[model samples]
Target chain A: MPHDHHDHDHLSASGHPYRKDNDGQLTYWQTMEIAIRELMVEKGELTPAQIQAQIDAMDDRSPANGAAVVARAWTDPDFKKRLLANGSDAAREMGFDIGPMHLVAVENTIDTHNLIVCTLCSCYPRNLLGLPPDWYKTREYRSRAVREPRAVLREFGVDLPANITLRVHDSTADMRYIVLPARPEGTDEMTAEQLAELVTRDSMIGTGLPKSP
Target chain B: MTLTPGSTVRIKTMSPLGHIRTPHYLRGKTGVVERVLGPFKNPEQLAYMVPAPTRTLYRVRFEMGHIWPNAEAPQDTLDAEIYEHWIDQNAP
Candidate 1:
């Protein structure tokens, strides 16, 4: 195995000891990440074009597309029906496959809510959302996401009472999730484009709800 | 002993049980013999740089609810490649 020259600096991004510069850069960790990424390219493990491809593809993230889906769902009941009937197909109809991921939606109601986690490793639906946030793959997230989902959700600003069921979704299988959070109030007259703007990635991931502006 | 060919796994190290690439989520869970597959060589030691004698590998299936009750899922099946060494008699 190729020894990671950035092993020492990687500790910062690994959630152990992170030190920030006055300008707020990860500094040493960033340096190491660049070095490691460059080394992987130099060794032909990954190419500069591949890195650029990923960068170019970043804006094409699934969350953004999911937001548009939600916007469409909100506007047209037929679209909503199609979405619920076939998650992956519905996403494709909107112009993309949630990727290789199997899209499963968790419907929320006045009485229950859903949250997702990958207890073993990060098994996110990259097709629909692109790469997952770093925090989603931590040991703390893996252990706690299953055991104390309610508590973890609270940290993300979701505080539901005991009467409201807090369902935790441990993504152990090939299946992945995208929470269709309830559309907030005052969006009745909003255009699809306007509504899509309000749908944040975190909200679709079930970490929060779209705010009314 | 049913892990088939071409499946991803999550292996861990053990003493008597030997090092198996079973995910921690299904560590103690028991799965029925879905399908008995070939005697492929274990990849744990190779992946982790142990360089030990190769062992048998198998594919196993587990219920999703069994792994995570809070999972908001419509179906209930998770198939994974598991080494025979990690299986315990008490698994069920």
Candidate 2:
């Protein structure tokens, strides 16, 4: 018989393991969330299994998905053309299942640079890149990004030359944006998979550049 | 009327009490339409869970100096998605 490794102290009276979050004091919002979730489950509107599966799906998404797209664009001209023309369709073609997010791809060129922010709220391309970094949602970043993009980019270690025009995109409504960072030079020999290793989440957000090979 | 790309338009300055997507800084500022982003349900109405009508959204590109008095770089630009109702086509 297989030995059970369950720790007695971690188990409740009902023999169920205690969730880590259950230890904290329930705030008003947490209480409300529990109430609503229970009500929905009781009313048969949703199942506990369904909710867990949904969470699992969200957890599965990460910046790696976006890195692959960026790498593909770097290597393939036709894919890059389609990606620039229609970001949502191109991502769908790659089997990303980004849902109804109207993604717009802004390219970083030799003379132009692109940055994205949501001044109204923290609207990000969560489907493609997973949850945004904590700083991206802060009031400081949201306001500074549009007002002084050059200064903001400098803080992120991306100092643009005076010749390069900085373009800051405020995702106010309907559409989401993803920056197609300029492909680093001297990467002509690298494969798409190897190139993907260099695409960081910050690079996609236009706050930083891809890692040098 | 649908706004064409490259047409100059100004965002109307108004502070109605409700959930609004138009940023306060861009109000009364003029910009050129970068592209027509098609129609979307009015977020102001959708926020209240009401029957929202569709409104055309345009990507307007504004000069940094035009939007701010002490812009770090005047030549740099800012682009934002503005709804049809917030844009005035008759701006001089």
Candidate 3:
């Protein structure tokens, strides 16, 4: 049998020394994260159980929850009123607790469209719609979304009519924001469930729109 | 200072060292108070895992042309939530 050499030194593409741990096992940041977490737990800042519970809560959410609320808002005028008035309370009414972060739902109208972004950081309505997309966290998007919103919307394949003005909401503070996209023209006859299916995550972010028909 | 909706206010030009929620571009810019989002704990201090005092936050609206004067469209608008401390009652 040919001699099998199993040991091969692996190096990170960037040639960063921090990529390797004591035994070349874990990355420096990974090791540091573990150290910090363990220290916090040891110091009684927070228990591992508390961290796990928060993770579990986050894992339980998805875009479908927000879509369901949007669909309900489309079907029921009363619910729509409530959702616009107080988003967190309205979400709770639909069996979703949006945590301590106050959520604000802004409606898209025929005259104007609304786009949401966190220029300072990726501050999003995670309780209602789960974690944000990778692009939403990028610096390119964060800066461009506020500086040139119409251009950014175009890149997302959202070509708006000149008659309609665009409104960009930079979520720089505590209140989380979600866009209530306008109901597609041909989706009037669809059931709430059917309508929910057309409500894409990007639509709620104001980067795109619901499926037409 | 509490500002009613539709009243114009200017963002202060102070960038204190440490965690800040206000964006650099919006500093010293003028905008109208879209809505008062009520009082909340100061996030600038909260970021450092320290106790924070409650401060009033307002949703300030800035016109697109005003924010980016050279932009193609003048009808557009942008909104950002700013704390009461970072705003001046008088607009420039």
Candidate 4:
């Protein structure tokens, strides 16, 4: 097993030692993840070339895709209106899904900003982006994030306006949230590709805003 | 409830027995034991590591209000399967 450096979700009840099946019986389910991999190789689930084809068919998972959609929104006034009206369909029009959840898109005007946290698990928009960072799933993060978002963001060196309303979106199930930051000044002359580069993951997470380059 | 000196109350992330889906967010925060729900399997089954490890089941609760005070939504209760080892009985 790859250990993978699992998170520290240890409860006070976690003091017990790991129990190993003394008789030595490995449950089939225990081996299922690897089993599927082996089966694919043995059964020729796809040829080496075909595997690439499958991968291509699947949409890329990353914020880059979201950046593209936001860029389009910035360039096209009509698209921005549509995106605000129908988040799911507007994102679909951009050839994307929120990835993990179908939560709505709410814009942050001059007065309000939004942030997201998965109080349950890291139920993020996987389709919109690839794997989340390692810190996202840590127990310390999960426990303390929403309770003290400003503090957490400060750890990342983010300084938010005290007067601006901060909304914390907790992802319970498949539902997700995306922040539409107030477009920065002086970027009106930039191209869509240029705009895409400005929208960082932190900005989308509601901790920061897109910067002018 | 084993009464041992020097224990504290906290929410457990995984059950030592039975099938449970413990959220990563609630582990290690202080919560009162409303009442015992009885023994259960460790769904967060550490015993899965050992072929058959003995584990007892209990129902533990943490207040949703305690988790998020400003929660616009109203859900007063949160319950889950708790293994004996996952909790420590601390002073109220």
Kindly report, for each predicted structure in the order presented, the TM-score of its chain A compared with the true chain A. Answer: 0.73, 0.88, 0.84, 0.73
> lDDT tens string, model 3, A1-213?
121122235543435333223445678887788899999999999998898889879978888999999999999999999999999999999999787769999999989899999998899999889989889999899989988888898999999888998889999998899999999998878999999998999999999998887
Report backbone clashes per prediction.
Answer: 11, 0, 0, 24
* Model 2: residue A133 alpha-carbon error in angstroms: 0.5
Indicate the TM-score of model 4.
Answer: 0.56
Tell me the tens digit of each residue's lDDT in model 1 across A1-213: 233233554455337754334236457877897899989988989987787777667656757788888888878889888876667777888888455555766656677676777766687777788888788888987777655666677899887676766555555444567777777788788899999989987777667777785
Task: List candidate 2 stretches off by more than 4 Å.
Answer: A1-22
Q: How should the candidates be ordered by TM-score, best one leading?
A: 2, 3, 1, 4
TM-scores across all candidates?
A: 0.59, 0.92, 0.87, 0.56
iRMSD of all candidate structures: 7.6, 0.6, 0.8, 8.9
Which number leads on lDDT?
A: 2
lDDT of 2 by residue, A148-183 (tens): 888888899989999999999999998999999999
Q: Report the TM-score of the second chain of model 1 against its true counterpart.
A: 0.61
Clashing pairs in 3: none
lDDT of model 3, residue A70: 97
Task: Compute the interface RMSD for candidate 3.
Answer: 0.8
Tens-digit lDDT track of model 4 for B1-92: 65222233675555444533445555675554433434443444452564435454443444455666764322333433345666654425
Per-residue error for A49 in candidate 1, Å, reads 3.5
Tell me the tens digit of each residue's lDDT in model 1 across B22-79. Answer: 5566666655443343454555566577655644545455544666777544133444
TM-score of model number 3:
0.87
